[model samples]
Each structure stands twice: as C-alpha cells, then as structure tokens.
Target: MLISAEGRTYRQEAVAAAVIGYRFGASKVRVSIEAWLPDNRRRDVDNLLKAPLDALCHAGIYEDDSQIVELSIRRAGLDKANPRLEITLEAA
Candidate 1:
C-alpha cells in the first residue's frame, strides 16, 4: 500500500499501473502470468494474482475484476537473486 500526502492509501493495482504506465477499459480481459520464484517451493499461482488483478482494476484497465474472463499462469523458473512477476493483460 502507498499512502498519499492526502491520506489515501493506494492499492497495489494503482501503484503498479502508475509504475508501468498502462491502463485499460474493456468488458472482458485475458491475463497471462509468469512468476519467477526465489526458490523451488511450491505455491498456488492464484494466490499471487489477486493484488495484480486489483491493480489492473485500479488503473481503470477494466471496471472490475469480474471482467477478467480468462487467466493463465506459469512458473518461469527460479530467480534466487531477484524474483519477480511478469504479466500480460489482453482485453476484448
């Protein structure tokens, strides 16, 4: 969460939108995710997408997460040094 000087706490979706400089407004969406993990430990991919999807909504890429009609996720292998997530969002 990011707190504004005005005392508004920005969500991860809003922060990511501001950082990536992208926005969308579509009735339906498809998302592809690549998660680079720090270790080989197993985790649920669905758990990791909530914040990002929320961020997309905050960025006005869509009116709400319910617009996301398709979703895909995959492990992009290990990144012991700098784990990160890569996402691709498509609207229809």
Candidate 2:
C-alpha cells in the first residue's frame, strides 16, 4: 500500500490515537483485517494493509510492523454507504 501524503494525514488524524488506546505494548502481535468497501472495487488486500499497519506502528500500537506474527485479511462484502475497515490486533 503506497499511502500518499493526504492518506497518511488522514490516518494520522483519524486513527492513530484510537489504535494506541486500543492496543497494549510493543509485543509480537496477531492482526486480522476486514475491509468492507463501498463498491465493487477490486483491491489487493496485501497492498491495502501496508498503510493501516504503518499507522498502527506510528500510533505506538507496536514497535514495528515486523512485530506482527500472524496476519489475516478478508474482503468482507460491500457496505456501500458505510464502507469501513475493521482491524483486530492481539498479543501473539
């Protein structure tokens, strides 16, 4: 996932802090991601994960993305008007 400046800004402003609050330490972790897109847009899950995972790291949710021991990705149907991404990070 190549995040542009605007996208990085959005993640920093909108999600970083929340991820920090929801997470614990710099321990090895497991992550599950579910992205409910707004339309029938084709997206690469691996590519999609790069930015958010980077955001989580920047938020201090973990020391680094390398700390992720197990990762799962799902293209969870479409939510049209309410497209959203759900991420679950747990101690591994």
Candidate 3:
C-alpha cells in the first residue's frame, strides 16, 4: 500500500521515539495504545494501529508485529492542544 507523506512522517517519528525508548527481545508482548484525538470527530480506534505498530517493529522494539500477543487501543477523549498517542509495550 502507498503511504502518504504524512504517514511516512508519522512512522519516521514513531521509529525515532522507539529507538530512544525501551527495546524488548524476541518475546511475546502486550501493546496498549491510548489515543488523544485533535478534535471531537468520529475516528475508529482500530485505524490507529497499523502505522505505530509497524513503526515500532521497524525500529526494532521487538522481533516483529507478530510478536504482539495482546493489543489494546482506546480513545482517550480530545486533546486539541496536544493530540498524540501514548503507547506502552510490555512482556505478555
């Protein structure tokens, strides 16, 4: 699939952050994602998964996205002042 420039930038930034964060070895992991939307617009939480997951994998956070044994995503209301995602990765 073709990634737009914005998507590419997001992935790049995610990868950079992952590099600065923790890294887990090849093991089962649980991922929790809390998304703060920029506005009170309809958005599917699932839609937010792929890029960050792929970016984390690309950054070598773990072996691969397949290693994610459990995943959780939730919309934590609007944060127009600072829209962002808070991701937590831990051994499953």
Name the candidate that leads on TM-score: 3
Give the per-residue lDDT digits (tens) of candidate 3, residues 2-83: 8999989988998878777878879999999999999987888899999889888878888788889999999887889999
lDDT of model number 2: 0.80
Residue 77 miss distance in model 3 (angstroms):
1.5
> Per-residue lDDT for 13-76 in model 2, tens only?
6464574376657688999999999998677878878777877777777778888899999998
TM-score of 1: 0.72
Pull out the clashing pairs in model 2: none
For each candidate, the alpha-carbon lDDT, in order, equals 0.74, 0.80, 0.88
User: Which scores higher on lDDT, 1 or 3?
Assistant: 3
All models, RMSD in angstroms? 4.6, 2.6, 1.2
Of candidate 3, the 10-residue stretch with the lowest lDDT total is: 16-25
Ranking by TM-score: 3, 2, 1
* lDDT accuracy of residue 1 in candidate 3: 83
Query: Runs in model 3 with CA error above 4 Å?
Result: none
Which 10 successive residues of model 2 have the least lDDT summed?
14-23
Which candidate do you rate higher for TM-score, 1 or 3? Answer: 3
Q: Candidate 2: RMSD over Cα atoms?
A: 2.6
